[model samples]
Target: MPRKAPSITHKRSRASKPKVTTGCLTCKVRRIKCDESKPHCNRCLRTGRNCDGYAPPLPRPTAITTQPTSTIAHLPSLSAVLISLPGTPSERHSFHFFLSHTAPQLRGLFESPFWSQHVLQACLREEAIWHAAVALGAVHGRFYAEGGEGGERQMWEGEGFAIKQYVKAISCLTRRGGGERRIDVALMACVLFTCFESLRGHHAPALVHLDNGVNLLLELQSLEKPRNLITQTYPPTPYTPLSALQALLTRLDTQATQLLPSRHTRLHPVSTPPTHYETFISLEEAQRASDELWNYCLYTLQPSYPSPYLHPQPQPSHDDLAHRQASYATALTTYLTTKPPRTAREQQAGHMLRLHTLVATLSLSTTSLPASEDVWDTHTPSFAAIVDLARRIIDLDTDVDIYAPETGRVGLDTGVLGPLYLTALRCRDPMVRREAVELLKKERRREGLWDSTLLAIVAERAVGIEEGGCKSELDTGRISDVDVVFDPEGCRAGVRFLLEGGRGSVEGHRGLVLTTDLPRGQNTY
Candidate 1:
C-alpha cells in the first residue's frame, strides 16, 4: 500500500523538443556541422562552395525493387525547394511565363497531369528542371513577342539566354550523378528540351530528343522485373509520374514513326499487342493505348521494312499481308472492348479514341483492295461516323481554336486531326470528305509532326488528285494510289500521284501546296 501511494505521486517531467541536425546537403557531404538555418545556412554562405539548400531528405527505404540500388531519397516539398530558386528578375519572369502560357499550350486540349502538376513540382525539387523550365518559358515568350511566325532562326538562335539556360540544365543533371531519381530528372529535362526544339522549328533535334526519351522510357517500362514479396516503394515520388511521362512520350512518338530510318521503336514490339487490354483506369491510359494502336495499325500497313530512299520496298506476300491485316483488325476490335473512365474531359477523350478506332477498324477492311477506289464506298457509314465525331470535337473546342492568335496551339496529343484527316483523305463520299477537310481547316494547328494546315491542304489536294477535288463518281481512286514520302532531313514531301490524276493531270496538281515549309519541327502539334 505504501509503495502504490509513492508511485501514484510520481509526475512526468516536461522539456523542450530536441532539434534536428541533419543539416544542408553540402554540409553533410563535407562532414561539417550545420547551424540548421532556413533555406541557406550562414556557414555555407560565408564559405566559397555553393550551398545545395537545406531541407531534410526523405529516407530511401530498402524495398523490393526492379532497380534497388537505383532508388534514392525523396525530394522536399515545393515550398522548401522554392527557397533555393534564384531571385533574378528575368528568371522570375520566365518561370512565371512557363507557368502561365507555355505550360497550357503544351497540354493541348486534354488536361495533362504531367504538364499541369508533375512538371511544376519537379521544377521546384530539381535545379535542372528549373533551368529547363525557365529556358522554355523565355523562348516561348520571345516567339510570341516576335509575332510567332517570322523569327524561326531569329527567335531560336538569337536567344542566347534560353540556350544558355538549357545548357545549364544539362550541366546540373551531369553533376547530379547516378540514381533512378537522377534518371527521372534527366527524362524531365528531355521532355522540356523536346518542346524547346520543337518550338524553335528544329525538327531533327526535337525528334532526336523525343525518340531517345521514348526509347529510354520504353526500356524502363519493359526492363522492370519486379521482385515478388511484401511490395513497397516509399516516397515513390520519382517513380509514379513516369506513367504520365510515358503517356506524353506516346503522343510524341506518334508524331512521326514511318519517317524513322529504323524501326527501333517500342524496341521489341510484340508481333501483336495483347489480345486484350485491361479496362482503362483513366482517360490518359486510353489515349495512350489508342495512339499506340494507331502506330501498330499504321505499321501493319507498311512493308516489313520501309526505305527513306526512292527504291520501293518489296511487298510482303499477299497471305502475309492478309494475316497482318487480320491481326490488326482483331487488335482494334479488342481495344474497343476497354472503355475509358467517365469524367467530362475523359469522356471527350474517349469519344475521340473510339471514333479513331472505328475508323481504323473500317479502314483495315480495305487493306487488300481490288485496285479500285470503289473499295472505300462500302464503308461510307463508318466515314460518316468519323466526320460526326470530329464535328463534335470541333464544337466542344469552339471557344478555343487549334490556332491561337499569338504562339499558336501546339501539343503532343493526337487530337481530332489524325482521324479527321484520314477520313478526308480516304473517304470517297463527297459530303464526308468535305466535312472532314472543313473541320481540319478550322482547327488549323499542328499535331505532332503532322501539320493540320499542310494536312488539310493535302486532303483538299488529295480530293483533287483522286476525284477532281470532289465526290464525283467519274474519277475515283484514279491511278490506284498516291505515295507521299516525308523526308524530314531533306525538308521535302514527295507526293507521287498514282495512275496520274484523272480529273486533272498529276503534274497540274503539283502546284497545289499552299505553305512552303513545316513549322521547322519545333511544335508538338
Candidate 2:
C-alpha cells in the first residue's frame, strides 16, 4: 500500500542520521535500518525474497515544486481531495450508494460526464464534494426506499446522517474561504445542494440554491464581458471539467428561467447568438449545440441577470424572436440530416433535442400576445407533436421503469417532463392534453424545477374545472394560465388560474386558487 512520494526526498535527523532511502518495501515495513545499499537491499538480496524495489520515493509536492500553477490548479484540491475517505462502515455504504445509484440518476438521459466523472473525481480531492456526495446518496436512498418499508425510525436516522454530512460539506467549504478557485468549488456544491432539496420536494429552496450557482457563474468571468451576463454564460473553451460543470449549470439556469419570471436588468443585445453550426462530427458536438441553442432560446424569454430585480422580456421587436427561432430550427434540421444516429441512445437523445426546439418555437409564436391565455389553443397541432415526441422519448429510454427500477423518480436537468407539462397545461384539446396528463401521471419523478406528479395534478384539475365544471367531468369550457406556487417542502403547491366560462366557482377551490398535496403512489416523494 505504500506509494513513493515524487516531490519529497529522504530526510536526515538533527543528529545527522540519514533517513532510510534505498530499501525493499518489505524491509522498510519490518523497520530494518538500511545501509543505504545500492542496486538492491543487502538484507532482501540475502533472503532471496521478491523485492518491490521502492524506486527512490517519488518527491512529494511542495510550494517549491516545479509544476506550473495552472497545471497545479487543475489538480484536485489536496486539502480536501486527499484529506479523508469515508471512515465509518455506514459512511462507506452511503458513499458507495452515491457512486453507484445516486450519481447515475443525476446524469439524466444524456449521461453527462460532469456527474459521472468530474464530480467523483472531485470527491477524491475535496472533502466538501465528498460530504455533499455522501449526503446526496443518503438522501436519494431515503427518498426512494419502498414505502412504509424502511419504517419511521430508520428513515429519521438516515435523514439525520444526511443532514450531518450536508453540514460537514458546508463547513468544509467555509474553512476553504476565498482560496484560489473556491467559487468554482462552491458552484459545484450549490448544484448538489439544489438536487438534495429538489428530491425532498422542496423546490423553492432548490431554486434559491440553483440561483446561487447561476449567479456565481455569471460573475465567474464578468470582467471579460462587463456588461452582458449572458455572454459570460459558457466557457470559451471545452474538454476541461469546469466546462462540463458550466454546461450543467447553464442547463439548470434555463430551467430556472422557465419556472419564475426573473427580476433583473434586461440588457439590449448588440450581438447575435450562436445559431450557425455546420454539422455534428461527434456526440459531444451534438450535445453542445443542443445545450447552447436551448439556453439561447430560453434566454430570449427571461432576459434576467444574476441580480434580483424585476426584469420582464415580454417579446422581441423587429421580428427578432422569430428570426432566431428560424435560425435555430434550421441548425437542428441540418444536424439530423448530416449526423445520423448509430445507437438507440443517440437516437433518443436526438429526439430530446428536437422536443426542446419545438417548445422554443411554440413559445416564440405566443410571447407577443402575453395577455391572451387562449393564444395557446392555436398551437394544438404543435402540442400534439410535443406529446407524441415525449411518448417516444419515454418508450425509448433505457432506464424506464420497465427496464430499470426506481429510475423514474429523479433527474437533475430538463427532460420530457417540461415539454409534457407545457402541453398538458396549454393545449386545449382534451385528447392531446389528457395524453400529456397520463404521461405525467406515470412520471413520479422531479425534473429540476418541474415535478411531473405535482404538475400532472394541476394539469388534470385545470382540465377538469375548465371542462368538468364544479360537479361534472363533461363541459365545453377551458382553463387558462395555471399559476403554481410550490411550498418550500415540495409536498404541496398552491394553484391559481382563470376559467373561461367561470363555471367552477363553487368547487373545493374557492375563486380559482387551490392548495393541493403531491399525489400518492408507489414512490410518491
Best by lDDT: 2
**Using TM-score as the measure, which candidate wins?**
2
What is the per-residue lDDT of model 2 for residues 1-525, given as tens digits with 9 covering 90 to 100? Answer: 011122211221212223343455444333346544655567665655434344332223222111112212343322233223434556655675565457766776565667656676666556787788888878777765432232422633447788798899889877864323355568789989988777766667777887787667655534445455534343232223455656776667666656543232122222345534555565556566666655655656553344333233354452675676677677777877788876555677778878988987888788777556688878999999999998888777542311232334467657788898888778888899899988877654667767766666667777766666458433344554455565664355566664454435533432343334444222235
| Candidate 1 residue-wise lDDT, 332-370, digit = tens | 445545653333344456567667667656756676665
Instruction: Note each model's CA RMSD in angstroms.
Output: 19.0, 15.4
lDDT of each: 0.57, 0.60
lDDT of 2: 0.60
Q: Looking at candidate 2, what is the lDDT of residue 21? A: 35
CA error at residue 407 for candidate 1, angstroms: 6.5
